[model samples]
Target: MKMNRTLFLITLLSTFAMQGQDSLVSNIQEVTQVADTVKKVPQRYKVEGVAAVVGDYVVLDSDIDKGYLEFQQQGVSTEDITRCQLLGKLMEDKLYLHQAVQDSIVVGDAEINPEVDQLMQYLTAEIGSEEKLLAFYRKNTLPELRSELFEARKSLKLAGRMQAKVVENVEITPEEVREFFFAIPEDERPVFSAEVAVAQIVVEPEITKEAKQTAIDRLNEMRQDILENGVSFATKAGLYSEDGSKTRGGLIEGVKRNSQYVKEFKDQAFSLLEGEISEPFETQFGFHILKVDKIRGQEVDVRHILVYPEVPQSSIDAAREKIETVRKAIVDSTITFKNAAIQYSEEEDTRNNGGQLVNPVTYDTWFDLTKMDPELSAKVYNLKPGEVSKIFVERDRTGKASFKIYTVTDRKEEHPAEYVTDYERIKELALKEKQIRAIEDWQNKQIKETYVNVNEDYQECEFSSDWVKTSN
Candidate 1:
């Protein structure tokens, strides 16, 4: 009941660190006076100055300040948030983490270490250097910062897993979705944004045979050195691999047989023995050499190096001209856009579907205008349904050039939610509401069973969960 209201407020407004010395003094004095009046302030708070403790985890007052600082940095308003609400969120997080530990939810080093590396990389780039990042965070060394980040990330991962487990089996039927939609007041129904169904034809640059051979030769040399010279595979991967996983020595852990790896990559990974490296193999992304580390039941841990051939400018020009030819045919009515896409588009995933782009976030055919990529929005904005855009060169994350032409298949103007037309969105909302209820029920039950203690200053704060008043 109160959970939704409290969470909504929390989302809109979270606490900010005390801005002025006067404000900080006021907070300390208020809590201090509360402590003096009660005459029952916990000794741990006096010593460690923790705000609250839930199960095995302690929420420090400084942690709440840091939370506020993060919210402030993200430009969230903290004007009216109370320390009590901040502490409540920390307590909820701790509760989830504590229960995750009790329930034996495991987060491995392989998962956490990469995240730490990525965070460090991002912060270093943002702060200008690793030394500046260390100084900004007041950390003396990289390992210290990494250790702290590791614990934080592990706790976050555990909390997320625990929350997900709470509603893992929640399901909503069509009847439930229908009922949920009509139950909303007519005027209170959400306004659906303008959305468009878009399709595109992509022509990828064909790699020259010489360039492809060069990439394969490089991998073969690296693999040979790794085997014959007793050189570290990780070292070669870190030095030469073009993939993002290079920072972690190209390590990918807990990969399953059903993982979303390309078929060639997965087949090579599954066929290798521990400590055995594979020969150079080709995938759509490019050539790779992988070494299996260990096998645990259905999961395998492996390290790989990826290398993509350099695309010649001639190939780029050829791709552009090819797409241009296709676009001309479509515009002149020689061939339909869908037929051209099916026959000529090189983007394999969408080619079979007539190059219709699915919204990755919603897994739907429609993309909301406001949230669509700016470049894509600009291209499709003026085009009415059935109009195709001029050929545009696009680059992949690796900066490989391609040419694409887009067609706007359908468009919807902003309107109040209609049950018939917005059934999928309605179903998503219904499922989310059900999951929230399930989480609330879980919290209510867990609070009674878990060890919880709040400072006297926060005992009076109204919490959505029964954090302050759990009884035997």
Candidate 2:
């Protein structure tokens, strides 16, 4: 259940990289316009000055302003301390980018297109519609926005790759973890929260072959209506598509060939020509029919109508009955709970780990009681360690209802963190600190060796690293 911190860092880098020059300038302009309205000042401004030069890369004052504005928008106070920290992080990012280019790291469209599509989808949703988003950014279409953001995305992936290379071999031993735990001052020690470790045996409600055929038949009917009844595909999609984009006429625009869509969906989309409607196709989500509106090079604009098959009440009852039998076997000591989970559980991710539930944030088996699912927390509130709860139905993130049996393996009351009991948690903390130190050391060496020129304006600002040395 350990989280890959390196992957987390890479994702963070990609997000930062998505904030291209135009987007940053737009943000700054919005803020400036708001101020102008309040103070009755002119909205026009002179050119922004350079803040720093890292090797061959130049950091603009607008870049710093963009970072500052992002923090402010996030409700972070733009006081001196926070501002200095933000500036330091930005400088370090530039250093990574410059070094990545020097080291010949190549980031291709395959690595960037998916992230671009995701970001565009999020922004479009945030602004209520793609039309509104385009108007807000003064862009005529979504493709224009993607083009503007492409270089920044590429630079971000390069920086992420460089960071991965730096920390790929770092590891921590048990002794190191113990030493790191004891070294913390008593007052600085972390207070532990009440936590529980639970294991589950899950069985998904099965959709019968007949149910799948029913869904396929329904989709085929819709397809025939579109082709023969002179019904518009978008109109049919609006009336029947089960996806969130049904409100938008089931349209998805500016989708690249390499975007992270389902393989079936992408394959069908890329294979079709403009004004073509595909036959009903089955994907994990449901039965879907693709209508290609337009295709340009590797990108396409398309619409789809999805119809998910329904799981009958009998299927749910049968799954619940199956788990009840497994529970009985475990209770009668015929088989151990862990072995039962290994042999009979339908949940793939947790089955091999003895059906243990992991906290996504901490990536550990122990979950904070307050953060658990309301239904799950309520059920285990009174149960003692090693107690099993009765069979229950719960819907997963995707709304796929499943029957489950849960066993509370371990529980602990809130207390101060201890080396003996919290070794794994402490090890994770120590490893993170080590990784940060390693990155910092690398950044310091790069700053000393590379040519860094800071404007006098920023030279007085407090920096975490000595980027403006006398030699430089």
lDDT of 1 by residue, 1-472 (tens): 4543454334322111122111111212111122222222112234347778899888887787666664454444555656777777788888888999999999876656655665666566556787877777789987798789778778767877777787779999999998899899999999988999999999988999999999999999999998899999999988999875786688888877776567998899899999999999999888999999889988899999999999998998888889889999999999998999999999998999998998755677898897666678899988899899988888764568888899999999999999998888888788878777787788888889998988776789887778878722
Q: What do the candidate models score in CA lDDT, each in turn?
A: 0.77, 0.72
Residue pairs that clash (backbone atoms under 3 angstroms), model 1: none
Specify the highest-TM-score model's number: 1
TM-score of 1: 0.78
Q: What's the distance in Å from true for residue 468, model 1?
A: 1.8
lDDT of 2: 0.72
Per-residue accuracy of model 2 over 181-249 as CA lDDT, tens digit each: 889998889887788998999988798999989988988898899889999889989899876556557
* Ten contiguous residues with the weakest lDDT in model 1: 16-25
